[model samples]
Structure formats: structure tokens, C-alpha cells
Target: MLKNKFFLIVAILLVFFVVYYTFFGGNTASVDGLEATINPATYGRQVVEKRTEKDQFLRTNAESPILDKASFRGLSYFAPDVSYRVVARLEPFADKTQKLVVSMSDGSEEVYEKFAHAVFSLHGEACRLLVVKLENTYSILFRDSTSGKETYGGGRYIELDPKQLTDNHAIIDFNTAYNPYCAYNPRYACPLPPTENKLPVAIKSGEKYIAHE
Candidate 1:
């Protein structure tokens, strides 16, 4: 009888421990846990981290000739700013066949459909950008007043997730803006931003121009 009682006590204690751990163990995880991970700082860090990884990848890639032979420490970027992150209204261009001829550095033109426009504000100044569909994701290539002086002369690019657009509103984070490959190598023919995508305000965020050595 004592042996049976001891076995029952052990089984009861084991079940209670399992239940408590199953319900409470996940709380001990990092602050960036499974559900509460979305935040502005997290996004900013992710952008910088992704860019750093990309630069390293480009520097070592055999096919990426831009950084393979060029001696450079790393790509330049403005400090991540949450102010550059804005929620915009995604307005569709009425004309279904509206196409834009984006000039390439190689003196070539790439035809892109202007599917939509993202209208947002920066430092209280109104800004807009043309959106183009690239395969499965939407993208924007734009230039601001800071283009020549701070960012890449050819401007910067940002990709948007179509699935994230809710009720015609999308979050456009300019802090994640990046320069074109042509900025690093002339052999790369990158598409230039069209006239409509130019902003009057200086966007002091994103990748800067790196002169080729």
C-alpha cells in the first residue's frame, strides 16, 4: 500500500510540474518573444542588420563584381531614424497600362508599370512615390532633396509587402532605403527614379553614395 501511495504521489507531482512549465516556460524567453516582437526599434535594428549582412555578401560574392575588387571598409548609411517611418495611403494609378521609362546608368531604359502611388509626410512636408510591381513584391525608387548631398545621387529604393497593405494604407520606412548597385559599380545598370517620385524634403536616412575607388 505504501509503494502504491508513493507511486501516486510521484505521478501527481510530475503532472503538476509539466502543466506549470507548459504554461510558464515561454515567458522566460527574450523580450522579443513569439508575439510581442513588433516595434519601431526592432524594425530599425533589422534594417541595419540586414544591410550589414548584404554588404558582406556582396563584398565576397564572385558574381557581385562591384565590391569584389574594390577596397572598402563598408557601405555608408545615415543613423536609423524612426521619424522617417510613415504610414502612407496607397492610391492606385487609374490607368491600367500606365508605364514609366526609367533611365538606367548604362544609357538604357527599363519599362516599368506605375501600378500605385504612396503618399506620406516627412517633417510635416508632403511626399509621394511611385510604386512598381516586381515579381511578387511592390517597390519604390525615389529621390529626395538629400539625394545629391547626403544619399545616393541616383536615389534610394524600398520594397513593400503587398500583403501588409490594409485598407489602402501601408507602412513605408525610409530608414530602410538603400542605394543602387550602380552606385558601387558602373557595370551595374540601375534604374533611376522618375520625376514624380522626387521629394522636396531632405530624407537624412538610408544608404549614402559610395564613390568607386
Candidate 2:
């Protein structure tokens, strides 16, 4: 009798596990091979190198900078903070076709499609951020309290891989946050970050403010 009861309990537990995995766990991408071996420090290093290369390119060929007259001391950035690198849950917007009217620096308006709402934690504070897409590319444009002070008043931007959007996991690394071209030169019309995307904390990572002449 005892043996029979033990077998019955095991079978019941197995069924419960299967149900949970099918509904919830199944939404996440299966971690296998190289992805399982990723190290945070290695990923951080790669991001820093990429940002440096971009700055080099912009300094040489970017028309937004008054390169002919302004003194370029190279771009500035806060040291990469690992705390700002977070894996967020991607919650698809109720209506993918929802549109947002984005304002541009040159007194113009543009439309952006709502992609999804990213639920994530930053500095121990839980928050939800809107994800926007233009054409087939997805990205996040946000403004933090650091803006107009430690960073660009127009806000900062980061690109998101479309593959990761519905994988249930989205990687948001503030270390890659960048200023729009308008931050350097008003000549280029750049989209202003929407008020709904503003954060209350100081995100002291990524690019720093460089006063343009």
C-alpha cells in the first residue's frame, strides 16, 4: 500500500510540472550551447569597445559636429556600470499598430509604431518602459533625470534586437545609451523622447554632455 501511494504522488507532481512548463516556461527561449557560457564581464567589455569605435567614426565623418571650428576633446562617458545591464520581460502591447506622435527638434512631427512594453528593474526600482519601432527596426528612446545635466537634454537611445523582443527576455544595457545627433548640433532634426518614457532616477552611465560651440 505504501509503495503504491508513493508512485501516485510522484505522478501527480510530474503532471503539475508539465502544465507549468507548457504555459509559462515554454515562452522563454531554451538556453543551450554558447549562450549558456556567457560571462557578464566579457559582454561588458565588448559593449565598451563598440562604443569607442562609434565615437571614432563620428569624430571623423559626422557632419553634426562643428568639426571645422569646435574644439573636440573626444566624447565623454561614465564608466560602464554592470548594474545598469538588466534582462527585462517583454510584454507585447495590446495593439501592435498603436501610434505615437513624436516631436522633432526642428519643429516637426513624426509617427512611431508601438512595439511592446518592457518591464524591468533599475537601481532596485521596478518600472515599465514603452518600446517603439520604425520600419522593421525596434528601439528604446528614454530620458532620465540625468538629462539636461549629466547627459543630453533631448534624451538617449538604444537599439533592441527584434529577435529578443518576443523571446520573453530583453537585454537592456544602459552602457550603450547614446545621444541623438541634435545633442551635438541643432542643425540635425532629431526626435524628442516622449514624456511617457521619462525615468525619475539619474542613469549615470553611457554618454556625457559635451557643450557644442
Candidate 3:
């Protein structure tokens, strides 16, 4: 009787294992479904470097900067804290365009304008341009610098709150910038970064291409 009970228990455990694997294990259909949703090919092409625990913690928990009153093209503003690394450079723009004009606050002064054409990336996606001046606000623009070559050519962007602009400088990390959903799949219509926003540098930080074997 003791031997029979042991055998029964063993058989039951085996059955449970089989059921779990069949439902949620490495089934081909399940894997295919995941790929269909996010396009593993595009994901695999990306390369994401690991971040230090301190940097990760800061990125997730840092408090956003609060500005008294920032406006771009007459729009209200709110600033989002960005942090990224510089990458490489692309081709220069025509007409000997060298730098991009950036406005920052220097604490003592109310507003300070400077040029920073040397935009870097955390990943392959290069930054593109799309500056729009709406009623009371200005639309901050950017795009994937490596669209066709390394990343999605359609590109990605971040919206800046003009109200947060201060004399003090803000961190613009390319690693934090990401591609839109359309880059992974063709079911969405994402706005492409305009030509003016294109940075002539290669940003090699942030989330990399997702890959699956």
C-alpha cells in the first residue's frame, strides 16, 4: 500500500507539470503571438545597455522641475526631467547650419538662450525636429535620428512643457527617448519628427532593440 501511494503521488505531479507547460510554456503559438504583437525582429535589432542602480532609481523616482511660468510660442508649460548620453554625429545640415538654438535659465537670470546642435542619443534613434508655435504654447519637437539605418525610420518624440523653462539647464538624455508604437507595428499613425529637429549625432544610450531567438 505504501508503494502504491507513492507511485500515485508521482504520477499526479507529472500530470500537473505537463498541464502547466502546455498552457504557458515555450509553445510555438505563444511565442508567435508575442512576436505578432511587438515584432521581435525590430526588437532584436536594438541594443540596450544596463544602467547603474542609482541612475535607475533616480530616473524612476526623481521629482520633476517646477517652473514659475514658461511658455513656448504662447503655450503653457510644465517640465519633464530628462537624462541621456551623447552618441555620434550624422551628416551636417545644408547652408552651413551648425548648432541648434536652445533657451535655458541660469538661476540669476530670468531666461537665457543658447545653441546646442550637438544633440546626442541614448540609442540609435536620432533626434528629429518639429517645432510648432500654437496660440499660447510652443510644441517641443524631436525624432529618431537613426530611423532607416538602425532604428525605426518613422521616429519618436517627447513633449516639453514650456512653462518649465528656466535659466537653470535641464538634462536631455537620449536614453529615455523611445519609439512610438507604430515603429514596432504598422497599425498606428505616429507623427514623424520634422527635418529641422534632426540632430547630426548618434545617440547610443537608453532602451535597445528587443530581440528574441
Q: Using TM-score, give the best candidate's number.
A: 2
From the highest TM-score down, the ranking of the candidates is: 2, 1, 3
| TM-score, cand. 2 | 0.77
TM-score of each: 0.75, 0.77, 0.34
- List the lowest-lDDT window of 10 residues for candidate 1: 29-38
lDDT of 3 by residue, 41-118 (tens): 332233121233422332344331112112211111112212242222322234333333332112121211212233
Error of 1 at 63 (Å): 2.9
Residue pairs in collision within model 2: none
lDDT of 1 by residue, 1-213 (tens): 999999999999999988866765533433212221135555668888988887787777786646545675677888887777677877897787888778987899988887788787779998778888755667899898888787788889988755546546677777778888788777789988888888898888878876754
- List where candidate 2 sits over 4 angstroms from the true fold: 1-40, 62-66
Give Cα distance to truth, residue 49, candidate 1, Å. Answer: 1.6
In Å, residue 57's CA in model 3 sits off its true spot by 18
Q: For candidate 1, list the clashing residue pairs, or say none.
A: none
Residue-wise C-alpha lDDT for candidate 2, range 140-175, written one tens digit per residue: 899998989999988999887555445466777788
Poorest 10 consecutive residues by lDDT, candidate 2 = 29-38
CA RMSD, predictions in order: 7.9, 9.3, 18.0
